[model samples]
Target chain A: MKIEEKDVFKSYFKNLTLRERAVFEGGITLGALFHQFVGTPVSLKNREILERSIEESMKNQPCVEDISVEIVGNLKEDEYVSLEGKMLDVKLKVKVENTVAYLRLRYIKELNYPLMYVERIDEE
Target chain B: MKIEEKDVFKSYFKNLTLRERAVFEGGITLGALFHQFVGTPVSLKNREILERSIEESMKNQPCVEDISVEIVGNLKEDEYVSLEGKMLDVKLKVKVENTVAYLRLRYIKELNYPLMYVERIDEE
Candidate 1:
């Protein structure tokens, strides 16, 4: 699982949009490395902060928008781990103000996939 | 092009989401077959009417919603047909009231892809 997570992160770090890549690099250099040593995975709160900082840094990119990312289905919880025992078919419904987009992914361990990264490029 | 179109449509007609399939079957049996002889591909207006009628019939399904499906790119027009010779890369942004979903497809000839067919299912 750790190897999979590391590989996924590495790929994302390579292919992230210019603005996103810059933010990721800056954050890692500044504090993320320290957090890793201290045993803290980038929390939702920290992620929001980083996203906002990145958004501000890249004027061409869209602002860090607040989106609701939820997992809906029958779930089985065991202490710190909540496993979705049922067919892990998850429907991600993302709404950016008046505009809404949906996606269906199955058996996803990590909730944060690069495709779902909502930092806008050009609105045409 | 005709073969490709026919094949794509055939798949869609076969996999028409239960309610949609019923509506399509009923329409073809009643009038679509008749229209085929008269040579009329389902027009936007007629599609709207059929969509509405189907919506009413399938109360479980979302009502026929009007959406703006626009092709945004520098396009070159050739008489009755406008060809987007600019790499044939099209971004589809579909908005349903407060929700908007987007997809990016390259080298697409047919404007009416079945995946873009927005007859609503359950809202979770």
Candidate 2:
């Protein structure tokens, strides 16, 4: 974002603390990542590009410092399946000023849910 | 969900009140909707089906009672554009037990953001 455009964007989030903002943006990104790609057609042929695409697109969101997305599953080369939440493992970092929130999205076997949660927060 | 499956899911959310659960599910749906389809190829020919497909897919999320998705923009017959956040207008209903949350995902020109928020909460 241009400096002026960023200022305008930051104005809307003035009410939140830096840590809060970081966590909020992380939550939004994690939620967006799961929902948007959960039903996509995926196969061994397209897996790598799909992961890179997801990482690149999510970088456009506010405060995304970095991200890594992996699609984990076994696929037969000839067939494709709709992407499922259980197959995603993501690590996201969101920065708001000095506060950086590390967040994760992965399926937890016990809960049987693709959980999104803040892993840690750091000031840098 | 089958009764047993639903019980397992509910057990994970036992720490949350019905209102919180409803809102959390609503937020996830909204964020997911924006991120998942923003860059999809869309034109007049595929717009209606795309909208229906999005609605159907999101309904699979937990607690989603109903959802309406409208893709608003001008599109030519022969060309397609990557769907943008500005084109989405969504109303989502999430129900947790007797509580219901109405959420919206829409572009607010003043904020220059595709904003997501809880519109209202109802108890039944």
Candidate 3:
């Protein structure tokens, strides 16, 4: 069997230890990219880099990235956008209270790929 | 077994017929939401709603959403942000050329969920 990027990613998450998972969470929310060091204190430098990036990107607004993830976030609003630059409408929900939201990179269209037209639906 | 939201989402994509996928793709890019009509014409009203949503969301960058998926997008730049709003930095890569990027709703930190610390890596 061939090892693909998706497989490597799946394996990485599947293999995370409890403590490691916690650290990973911290890195994500904090936007700190850390290189795991067996068992020891975290490096401040990596944490700083992540922090800076998060701030910069947020300021830019509607920015793009090679890779991106949101560990924990609140939806400013209930909304969805079509793939094309056109057509954007907001979905109003009665529950305006703070709700835990997840950011998913769905593949709706593909210029070239085995998979196209992907979407991220609520993970049950 | 409990039929979870994830299962439903997964099944929906898994079951998309080739023709349906093509129509779905059109809906996404064109920002048209279409209700599948078995083997008949699409519902134009739904398409109109979708188109409206896409336009509105893009105008408000850094905005939150209940759900989001970018099927095909060009990362304006190479970058990664730490989960915390504090960090914001850009990773400049030599390869500025266009590359297919995937947006993943990595579960680095989940407020509540059976599966936490979910990260979307390339599907190999």
Specify the CAPRI tier of model 2: acceptable
Docking class of 3: incorrect
What number of clashing residue pairs does each candidate have, in the order they appear?
6, 1, 41
> Over the stretch B1-124, how does candidate 2's per-residue lDDT look in tens digits?
5322465556655544566567656766788888788899999999999999999998987778999999998898799999999999999998877898787788888777777756677889
Comparing 1 with 2 on TM-score, the higher-scoring candidate is 2
lDDT digits (tens) for residues A48-96 of candidate 1: 4543442333222122222222323332333222222122222323222
Supply DockQ values for each candidate.
0.01, 0.25, 0.03
Q: Report lDDT per candidate.
A: 0.27, 0.80, 0.24
lDDT agreement of model 1 with the native? 0.27
Chain B TM-score, candidate 2?
Answer: 0.93
Distance from true location, Cα of A87 in model 3, Å: 32
Q: List pairs with backbone clashes in candidate 2.
A: A36-B36
| Poorest 10 consecutive residues by lDDT, candidate 1 chain B | B27-36
The DockQ leader among the candidates is 2
